[model samples]
Target: MAKKVSDIGGGRSQAVHRALKRAILDQALPPGSKLPEDSIGERLGVSRTLVREALVRLSQEGLVELRPNKGAVVSHPSLEEGRNLYLTRIALERLVVETLSGSLTQEQIDTLSTHIAAEEAARTEHAASIRLAGEFHTLLAQMTGNASLIRYVNELVARSSLILALYGRPHSSECAVSEHRELLDKLIAGKTDEAVALMTHHLDSITTRALLPRKDSLADALHAYAVAEGLA
Candidate 1:
């Protein structure tokens, strides 16, 4: 828990939000799991008000659903919903690659290469690799320098993580690293069509693995994330 309510009031709400978000993305808080305000507040040493605030923010980002009086739960996408999410992601990423093609600086290429190397190194750590894989797309969107695109990509990437956690089998992050490296090469080489095609194919492969089918203790779920966020 935080040392003071004032602390939570100031900026610790984002800490609470990050903890819950990380927990959800990593499947520590699986889809449809209850997120009671009091329990979260007590566990994180924040007030219910802060917890509610954090949850509201997550809800805005489509990671949490706020029921009228039942409080919040992780958003559980249906099979159809999940499919649509990935379809939309494919379109957005196509745009991302299009925007980035012929525009990638040597520095951006180096950054992406470094990120892929990190992904390769973290492949054995399932959760970290998954998070990094999703981040790779967001990094591309960030490079596009479109605020709206960045926001949408960030939200989609996060929800995609949640969806994969819910319905996906153990996938090969190694495959992702190789695909990302190839896609980057295409973009850096200014081959827009090939880059877009590869981007589509890469995202499609993940979608194929996901869109299939598919909980934990609330306090236990929140504990590790809260501690990581300096809330416990």
Candidate 2:
């Protein structure tokens, strides 16, 4: 059994959680990698109790898997799960665009434009580009001003990010950028039907890209992560 340390307390626990979550999202902890509480606790300078708490939070978010006797590992969504996740995301995003059409304030449009600029600036940086791509959808949901819908979209966006990390191949950022611009233009023009249709097509493109096979060995991924994190 992994030994649990109780001395570190709660404030540091949240930090542990954030660090672990960042690692997972950045694919520093790739799918199916074991998350030993002791190792993580030591790495982050937190207690095992803190690491376990962080793991629990991640599990609830569907980013970590908790096994009965084997401890925790990163969640690995199957091909079918990835398809279904994108399908659900498409439905929710369609709702987002439909609600925002003809109702977006000038300030909101400016904010979205700023976000797009940031995405463009990060286009050469793979992880940053992916994170910003997902944030674009979450920002749209936030504009709806519905807490419940925002929460749901946030979770789905995070899951979709993980799916892309696992299954997506390396490619130029131009396609996603162009698709987002088209969708934004439709929304700004108050073409609700066109915006909705474009949103559907954009999400379908993401799903199609995710379904393409990629050759990534576990050892290579882990080594890259270690070097990137200065753990090597």
Which model scores highest in lDDT?
A: 1
lDDT of 1 at 10: 54
Stretches off by above 4 angstroms in model 2 are: 1-15, 213-232
Angstrom error at residue 177, model 1:
1.6
Candidate 2 accuracy as lDDT: 0.82
Off by over 4 Å in 1: 8-11, 210-232
Worst 10 residues of 2 by lDDT: 1-10
Give one digit per residue, the lDDT tens place, for model 1 in 13-127. Answer: 8889999998888778888999999899888888888899889989988899999978789999765666788899999999999999999988989899999999999888767
TM-score of each model, in listed order? 0.82, 0.78
